[model samples]
Target: MTIDAKRIVVLVPARNEEHSVADVVLEVSAALPGATVVVIDDGSTDRTADEARRAGAVVLSMPFNVGIGGAMQTGFIYARERGFRAAVQVDGDGQHVPSEIPRLIECLEEGADMVIGARFLGRGDYRAPLLRRLGMHLFSAALTVLTRRSFHDTTSGFRATGRRGIEFFARTYPSDYPEPEAILLLCRAGYDVREVPARIRERESGASSITFFRSIYYMIKVLLAIAMGMTRRAPVRRRGEER
Candidate 1:
């Protein structure tokens, strides 16, 4: 079960993404040569697991569809357990471009525990709906006020994490609406989280998992989660005491 720690691994969390998983895997593999790509097929009823494997990725199929947060946590656990030095979270929906992975990794190598490939930091082709854009701004402002750090996109899932970040999330990751909450968790634990501008391609196939109706609920849940996170204390781990 020994894997190369020198190579940065790309972790893809997928659910019923039969149409796009293979392409994502191949692009990731090509984009980061020698880097291992693993797919967490989150209880997909389609051929996601098989397609990913056929595309030359190590696939871990979940028995049930945990939300995106849970699936990502699983990937972190896998990466940490295998002694990977770092991991990049790439979506199976094809929105996250593989070519931009190195930029995220560069930031990670420059001493950031977490590097978020932010969509709104610089000009990009990504254009969320007006309502979604407003919600993003609200979350960003709230996070900035609470954390004392500027946050442009609190909901972007495209990110990379160093070993410390991976281990931290492996131990205590949020299961629901994790992106925004994760920033708070890492900052509380004394980890450096940075953001780099990256572009996102609109999905050409399949509907997004989050619907318009669910987005309202998602916003409310995330805000409450962030508020609760502020009051809580992050557990500090002693050196060599990792579980």
Candidate 2:
């Protein structure tokens, strides 16, 4: 019997994304065949789970509404339990193009611990709102300072994680505003990262949850969490660790 060393999985953390859930899952399955696609349905009021299951992806439906961070941590735990070597964290929104997923795998195979799809890195006509872009840059600057590394995109949800990254976040991950906080956590954990050019499409349907007021507070709160996480160290004893 032979086993494959290169096991890749795509994780979609979704909530009330019935409009976009099926397409996202089907597209990923089409792009990367022979790999499992798991969609963590985060207590969607709509038909997100049904649509995802119909699209041929395994759906892990949360009993209650957990934020994106919790959904993502669930994916990490599944990956650890399943012994998957590489996993890609993709949003349920249609914004992330499934065609670009392989690039992240290539980044990991090429020896990078983490790869983030940067919209500014030779991208096409990106349509992110002006205010969001401004906040994105500000958070990027703050994260670089906190992690002591150079990173242009902190809030971009398009990213890939290797074995090291999967195990790291499964143990300790942020509760809110995790897309950026994960970057700081990974950097502080001594993981090497690479940013590559990728063309992301605009959201096809469903309104984004980020409002102007929440975006402001999200920026501040995430920045503070990352700063503190960077400075703190894990206790010598983990939950299941034997002393």
Candidate 3:
């Protein structure tokens, strides 16, 4: 399963990350030479789009700020429309290491529809705040139960998706708190979703959008979203079928 580098697209979804987006683009280009890197500028008032283009990345500037889910779906749609065989997600804030991307791609090559770069897998010394950590644990537990499989890091945004995953996600991606919900969605849809250890660093600039009270709000809202998702039947898909 040796995929051509030209057929792979690295999707970097960013918002107001002008300070670090260029560096991230450069690193992704260097790490995966010949792979197409597209940065989705989520309506940043700053110079995010300009910085990304200057760094040799294809920039997709949104009309306004669509959150992470909308930004990422735009990337997947681009990948699908352009007939990319695989899509890799790297945050624009430079928290995700480009060098570790190969690990996730390897899992995809090994037949995983999607591969998550798990931070708690002992490969990195990354630590989250107390409330955030608890929320992660809750989401992980709920996903494990819902999917009947183990999930170590449900909130990690670092991930890679093969063709099947790209097509599915392009059509049906959650709009809010998508990381954890996406795992359950793919798993329930009968996709091979796996996780691998990867290193994640602190963001180079800007603070997290999830603040103290926001964390609590995020937890409740996401749990409700997950519950609603569980009530619906997963879409039927024929394995290996292309849309």
Off by over 4 Å in 2: 1-6, 234-243
Clashes of 3: 0
lDDT of 3 by residue, 134-199 (tens): 999999999998889999999999999999999898888888779998888899899999999999
Write the number of the candidate with greater lDDT, choosing between 1 and 3: 3
What is the TM-score of each predicted model, taking all chains together?
0.94, 0.92, 0.96
The positional error of residue 84 in candidate 1, measured at the CA in angstroms, is 0.5
- Residue pairs with backbone overlap in model 1: none
Q: Who is ahead in lDDT, 2 or 3?
A: 3
Per-residue alpha-carbon lDDT of model 1 for 1-243, expressed as tens digits? 232435677999999999999999999988888999999999999999999999999998889988888888888889888888889999998999999988888888788999999998774778988778888898899888988888899899999999899889888788877899899888878888888999999885788777787889888998999889888776575444333
What residue pairs are clashing in model 3?
none
lDDT by candidate, in order shown: 0.87, 0.82, 0.92
- Candidate 2's clash total is 0
Error of 3 at 49 (Å): 0.2
Ranking by lDDT: 3, 1, 2
Tell me the deviation in Å of residue 190 in model 1: 1.3
Candidate 1 TM-score to native:
0.94
